[model samples]
Target: MELRVTNLACARGGLTVLEGVSFTLRPGHALVLRGPNGIGKTTALRTLCGLQPALAGEVSVPPESMAYAAHADGLKATLTVTENLAFWAAVYGTDLVEDALQRMNLDALRDRMAANLSAGQKRRLGLARLLVTGRPIWVLDEPTVSLDAASVALFAGVIRAHLAAGGMALIATHIDLGLDEAEILDLGPFKARSPRDGGPASAFDEAFT
Candidate 1:
């Protein structure tokens, strides 16, 4: 199924921040969201993922088909690496836990508690959750946070593989992920005319939630 956003308006803090936003991501394709900070990139992604409502316009996608990853990695401090992945696998009714661990290079730390892993490792584990979801669409916001250059390249390869496997991705990031086939959508022209707080934030403080 294709992910379509038509004349989408994204609002944050009860005010419209992005209007007339439109895009369509087909299978095996990627769309990158581009704009300055607080320009509603995360808000748009959240709306597409049904985490929040859209002020206007429409979003069309298959039901229960999206996996969202944002600034919050959604890690359980008490759970071991394997346990965390297996839990998500159970939730999504998939048995790709071992593949997720290997793809994210967490096999060595599988028995370790998430709290014991470093920041980059935690991020990788969080990303591994996507693999178990078996969802067709990935809506990610700044997915490269805390990743070193090598890890960034590693994740990029994972994304490329996902795309190659007929998956779609909608990412909001400032870093170049080296996906030459991915299309870029600049949210600047779609900026809302309404006044905003003009702060250095893109959405509510939902990190670690």
Candidate 2:
């Protein structure tokens, strides 16, 4: 599947957060969204994931094929790791079984409550949810936030494997994702105007000029 964003913009409380962001992500590849803090990276991901509305422009993808993981590790505190995985598996129709737990080194922590897991472990569990989710396209915001070196390497390996297997991802991160061939959409160093109360301008309008 292919995911495309064209001139995407969003407003929060009358402030324009993202302005005319555009990119295309295809299977076997990835797109890294880079920008300074408060530049709407998270908001952009949220809009793409349907958590927020797109005040302007378009996000084109099959709803069923998209999966989104936010910066906040959205695990239920009372649920066991395994139970959380089961819930996501049932929701997203992922069939990863034991392989995913082994990959994230969570087999031992599987029975532990999500509330007690360390920050890094919780992040890993969140990623493992992605592995079990059968979505073809992933929208990940700060995917490796609290991971250690070894866990980061493991996450990179898993991501590479995913791309090699014809999956696609759009990651918003400040750190290197270790994907050598990934496309980098650097929003920084761009002379972007802060959006007015109405929202940002559309890039498509200039496409005809």
Candidate 3:
């Protein structure tokens, strides 16, 4: 299966920020989005996950085929690392909680409450959710936000393994992941022009401008 975004247009606050964005991600491949802040990288990703409707174009992927990880760690502070993974695994109907714990190096911290884990450790735990998801497409937004160099490398290895196993990832990150299966897509050229440049600006557009 492949994830195809064709002539896509994504908006935020009712103002289009990216237009004519397109790419194809086949299994065992990954695509990294590159752009300045507010260029709609997250907007594009959110649209793909059905968090918001695309202003135009189409995204073709199987239903329930994507897993999204944003800034939120999505952890319950009261739960231990193992319990948290178990919770997500149960939600996703998977039995890979133990495996996720092992891969994320949380085996020792399994009994520790999420509130007690370090920021990087918590990020690792949150990303571990992807493992139990059983989804082929991973749509991540700045996934390395609080990770240290070593932790970033650890997570990159996880992503590499996922790609090697016929999975696809669409990541919006500033860090260079150095994955051989990856390609880059710059959203600069797709930046939306001001509505006033083409037509009268809508009141909503004026607020953002």
Candidate 4:
């Protein structure tokens, strides 16, 4: 699936957080969003997913083709891992819940309550949720956060496989994700705007080779 965002803008409480941001995403390629803290990285992802309303511009994506994984854990703490996956599978109209869990090496913890898992385990579980959706375009925010060395390598491997299989990813992260062919979209140098009474921001178009 191909995803495109044209002149995407967002305003929060009458303040413009992002403006005139445009980019095109193609299948089998990954785009890494590089920006410092509070630079509308999360806001951009939210706008792309329609979680945050765009003030102006176009975000074109098929309803089932796009998925967004936020920085926070999206699982219910009371539910077991398997239960969570089952719910996601039902919502996404997919029966790949079990397969996704197994691929993430979470089969052993399938029966364990989400609250009992460690932070990294919870992050993995969150990732597992996205995988179960089987969406072609994944907009991931800080996917490697709180992960140790081994888990980071595991994630890289998973992403590599995903790309090889013709899936696309848009990732916002400060750490190196080990994607060899990824195009970097650095969001720095855009004049920061205060959240109060919003100002239009210049779109970030400085692509890295």
Worst 10 residues of 4 by lDDT: 200-209
Stretches of candidate 1 off by over 4 Å are: 195-209
lDDT of 1 by residue, 1-209 (tens): 89888999878887678889988899999999999998889998898888888888998884489999989889889999999999999999999999999999999999999999999999999999999999999989999999999999999999999999999999999999999869999999999874234433444433422
lDDT of the candidates, in the order given: 0.90, 0.81, 0.91, 0.81
**Candidates sorted on TM-score, descending:** 3, 1, 4, 2
Task: Show model 3 residue runs off by greater than 4 Å.
Answer: 206-209
How far residue 194's Cα lies from its native spot in candidate 3, in Å, is 0.4
Our tally of clashes for model 2 stands at 0
Model 4 CA deviation exceeding 4 Å by range: 189-209
Which candidate would rank higher by TM-score, 1 or 3?
3
Question: Candidate 4, residue 108: CA error in Å?
Answer: 1.7
Question: Could you tell me the lDDT of residue 32 within candidate 4?
Answer: 95
Q: What global local distance difference test value does model 2 have? A: 0.81
RMSD, every candidate, angstroms: 5.7, 5.6, 1.7, 6.4
Which candidate tops TM-score? 3
Report model 3's TM-score to 2 decimal places: 0.95
Better of 2 and 3 by TM-score: 3
lDDT of 1: 0.90
Residue-wise C-alpha lDDT for candidate 4, range 1-209, written one tens digit per residue? 58888877775554566667878888888999987787788877887887767778897885467788887878999999999999998999899887878778899999999999999999999988877788888889999887898888888778888888899999999889889858998766442464233543333321221
Question: For residue 120, what is the lDDT in candidate 2?
Answer: 99
